[model samples]
Target: MNNLINIFFLFLTLTTSGFSQKPTGVWDAFAFGAKGDGKTMDTKTIQTAIDQCHAAGGGKVYLHNGTFLSGTIYLKSNVTLYLEAGATLLGSANVADYPITPSKYPTYGGDLVTDKMFIYAEEAHNISIAGRGTIDGRGDDFNGPYLSPSFSGRPRILHFRNCENVQVRDVTLRNSGSWVQFYQSCRNMVIDGITVDSRENKDIEKSRHADAKGRNTDGMDLVDCQVVRVSNCFITSGDDGICLKSLSPNESCRDITITNCIVSTNASGIKIGTETSGAFEDITVQNCTVFDTRVDAISIMTVDGARIERINISNISVRNVKGTAIFLRLGARNRTYRKNAKAATGILKDILIENVQGTRIGGYGCSITGIPGFLVENITLKQIRLRFDGSNKPLLSDDDTRKPVPIAPPAVNHTVPEKIDAYPRGEMFGRLPAYGFYIRHGKNISLDNIALDYADDENRSAIVADDVDTLEIIGLKAKPSPNVSEVVQLKNVRNSPNLPKSN
Candidate 1:
């Protein structure tokens, strides 16, 4: 075939001449004097224009417009810091101009503080922090509750460690004293169209040893990263708006993809692990939109010993959730340091949640707890629709408030308490006898076309399954709670064969 079309046109002309060769040293931080007027201190003239564009061999360190009050800036290797929309890199409230650098792979118990941030990089590769500029992490001039010893004396506004081809595009990231971006152990990362807000100052006025308020301003903390792609983000956070951690017991946060995000959080809008010590396989959260979340619009937990399996959540839409739209947990904290000092129990298997929709959920509504020999296996929830604002009124005793408050007589079969080193949370087993989906110690579970709705008269039971085995509920539509008359509750359930009864 004519010598195979000239060897495929010389391999497409050597891959389009290596993508048309264009990185050739722009380097213009006001030509290395870097004033930008936000009160001097442009961090050694933007690190001498990024070490003279990495010694004249790489490119683009330009920053245009105004407000550049840096503190600790260091990015190297084929750099591209190009900000120029009104350019403002401003972070520096003078906590000694941020100079620490502890963490030689030390996490909790080695007590991680890890300072030296405000745009830092280590072992870098093709790095980037693209335009539409604004990286202002002047987060309340740093003082928080984050385990306060002055909270590692505050830094972190973009710390990339052991990086690879990373790209942080269209940045707006604002007001973060800690964890506004800490992509540690990175790989091919691309955080596109970013706009994190970090809810600045958080009503600051507390001085008698200030305790809380934006105490871990997490907007993006993807630790032990791999092929990550967070798209079109608009995260607003006090903590946990988009967090995924696997703090290196051997490094694992495999192929992740968080698409079309628009999260709002006081904590946990899309979270994985409370810092699980390694292993979270292929994760995908698509077309997201959570609003006013106080916690759990989607939180998957493998308390510290890791091994969370393939997860997929699709087309989510939650609004005004003060807590629990979906909180999957498998405990046994075991905060890492194996070699047989007991730390091995952690495995939450393949999970898939599809077409979710929530409105007004609060307190212990969605849970999939596990621990009694560790169940939580293959799970799937398809086409779920939850709506709960049922006012939670079940305290009537002065002659029953117009009668019909009787659905509490089923208590003799105990075996729900295997907290397994507590702190997994969906209120940590407090008040749960189901308000809307409270499955426990699960096994191969599946719920197709589930719909739970409530707005006023609530007493309990929307769907509660304790000690489940092979549950498969299809087309469940919860309604019966004229004060609670069995809207599905089965304790000590075993080989559930298409179970779906009480309505």
Candidate 2:
């Protein structure tokens, strides 16, 4: 040990010359007395190396050739932790190993998340984590219940709060107790070439019953951030795969682009807000693939008085979407996120989704709905093809097969509800009256070159538009059910183009 210490100082001296003016060099964890034996606690030594690197005006803290069990790595400014291929940074299972990281940013329910975090950086700039190593949060061993923003005993794998110029690339991140990574109120971030897998099983219902350890392992969350890029990634999780949330009325999630990625999850694959207190603008998502998702493959919502606008999603492929292909909702769920926070109905508008294809979707159809006065506006879907699993029309009595179709005018009006404050879901209105698309309370919606089909025998209209304005459909090709009298039903719709022509 004495010789090792002498060699370390000698190497430092040789690298730095007479003065300790090393601008950039690799700071090895082993030099700081870290035993990467997987059983020992190397957190302090690794943190010390990071501190030294930061103090020396920035360098890389190298961790290689071992498995390091650690907790709560606090990354600082201009510092980067480069993990080599043979190294692994494992999260400690003990709950007390993580500290409580406080924040002033209002989010989800405005309650503090039960965390510090496994890898935490707060108010730091020009920070990064790049490598080929694996970071395992070991979420399977964590015991807790997910009850919102205040649930205890679960910690996020990575949390970068109020930061700038953050880059996370080429790492395998998985098994978080809650959301795998949370980037809140950050700017100018790039997350590229990363792989994340946190699913407990292929089937969520069976997995929840089989393993009752942890909950809510979403893949990645970008909250109220701007100017971000995410590309060349693959993610699959127990919850939403990639999420954009806006939880503060003062800040909006804007200027984001996500491309060339693949995601699968038990929840929605790509989503924007269950937390819509702010705006989502200038976002583009293209060249992505989503599969094996239990909810809508793509879902966008504005429920808490925020504007969702100027968003584009193109060239997306989906398979085995258990709920629907797409869901857009503008609701008046004017619930407060925090104390003294007011709520109001928001606007959802100016969205374009084109060149999307999907198969093996459920009976919920593609729903785009708004409340009475707040209409979803200026949405367009072009060159989209989707197939839904057929459904039998619900009957008043199953014993009599000759019952009249329950999806008539009076029944259709009552089939959809105005659940203003409820969380948005494609199936929230239950089985829709349409088999292909259910559009209500919408304005200036144009569906062009849409091809829809069903796997089994369906008994509903191909499209149903209620309270829709300026509705237009071109080259509308669909397989209408034999029992349905009309292929498309329009109620209280005004300013629409000619009735759709079947291709």
Candidate 3:
């Protein structure tokens, strides 16, 4: 049986390797009157080349050594858009050039017509965008006045909907007005070795605010996707680095793997769902590094009535996190229910996090919280180390006495309020009572070989548990502080044999 399993894996590896080789029968864009000069409007010419290539039994459409200015161009089936070295596919500045179509998903209160994307593909199979060049969305020109109350007038760089057997590799994508790449309902997708720098554009500084240049410029948004693999990418963006969502009903985001990625962003580094209407399962994230993020390093939440289970995360290192290092929440924010249908609460269970380390975290420390009657169950944390800046001094104020002093006392026997309908965020519950971790309303939780270090002496406990059942804390180490009298505090906790008594 072992030998047969090994042979099966070997065959799978070989099949994947064979698929990476370039396709044959390349058709150059310049041969079809596509002037490579930066000044020419080559939307129609370049698209014609792609159409001819697709009509001729599907091959690579090559762009080489110049800038091809284009508007929205639809990708056909069995087509590969290859950008050679020193090549660029630039987005046109005019919004009217890209025609609009009605959105497939419900847009709540927003406009129905929102299909103005730079490079779009819908219901196409065997499609790819590969090679070592760049796709530059000249996003500064589309930052006009707001078109609707919910959405702006800017377009995304790449949008693929309902595409199967897709691959995107070894390209540089930058400066998108909205999300850089959005893969919605795509199956069997592979994204590898891509570099994304969607930071604020320096060429045209139109916004008066400092961070408003690339508003809503998320690096990658995968919504309702399945069988996806994202690896070896470097992303720096203004919004969430890599986010997964389930926006459609009756469709789930499942069987996804993200590994060996380095991310730096102003928003969450890796996140799942602020729009979870379907299930999310069988996800794994490993060997990733996140730095200089304004939000949590890893955030998992299912606030919109979805079941989240079977998540595994390991070998993560985070630094300079402006918010919590890790956050998990399960709440009741059912935004997608039909009229007159009863809202349902979600389920969260079977999560494992191991070999994680973080440094320089800000005020709202790590948290795992669930609503009143619904507990986050079967969570395990092993071989974890965290460091937080425990200074009670106000970050912006210089007054030393402004810092509140600690008062040692027994754990308060009070139940935390269940903010079921509030917006789900790491900082949604004001200032956390603990410095390292705060777990509330959980079941079957375990923490092993965990260490917490603080930079300055401060008043809160290193760990706190409230309303938890079947808790275990083994080999826990916290830095000694004169102000912090206790390392662990328990309130209304049951079956906690390993925890020390609070003073």
| TM, every model | 0.37, 0.90, 0.86
Winner on lDDT between 2 and 3 is 2
Q: Model 3, range 252-326, lDDT digits (tens) per residue?
A: 899999999998876679998777878899999999999977667999998888889999999999997766788
Residue pair clashes in candidate 2: none
Best-to-worst TM-score order:
2, 3, 1
The clash number for model 1 is: 0
| lDDT, candidate 2, at 143 | 69
Clash count list over all predictions? 0, 0, 0
> What TM-score number comes out for model 3?
0.86
Report the candidate with higher TM-score, 1 versus 2.
Answer: 2
Preferred candidate (lDDT higher): 1 or 3:
3
At residue 5, candidate 3 shows an lDDT of 100
- The positional error of residue 65 in candidate 3, measured at the CA in angstroms, is 0.6
Output the lDDT of residue 452, model 3.
Answer: 94
**Which candidate achieves the best lDDT against the true structure?**
2
Model 3 lDDT, residue 449, Cα: 92
What is the per-residue lDDT of model 1 for residues 1-503, given as tens digits with 9 covering 90 to 100?
A: 99999999987885564222234457777766788999998899888778767876778888898888989898988889988998898988988888866655443344444564788887789989999989888877877446432236677789887789999998898877877888877899999998999764332122211344445677998987899999998988777789888766677899989999898866568988777877999989999898876657898988777889989989999987655788899898776643433356789989999999988776346888788888899999999998976645322111111222222333212234666766564545544667688888889889898999877666677888888888888888887777666788877777775675321
The lDDT ranking, best first, is: 2, 3, 1
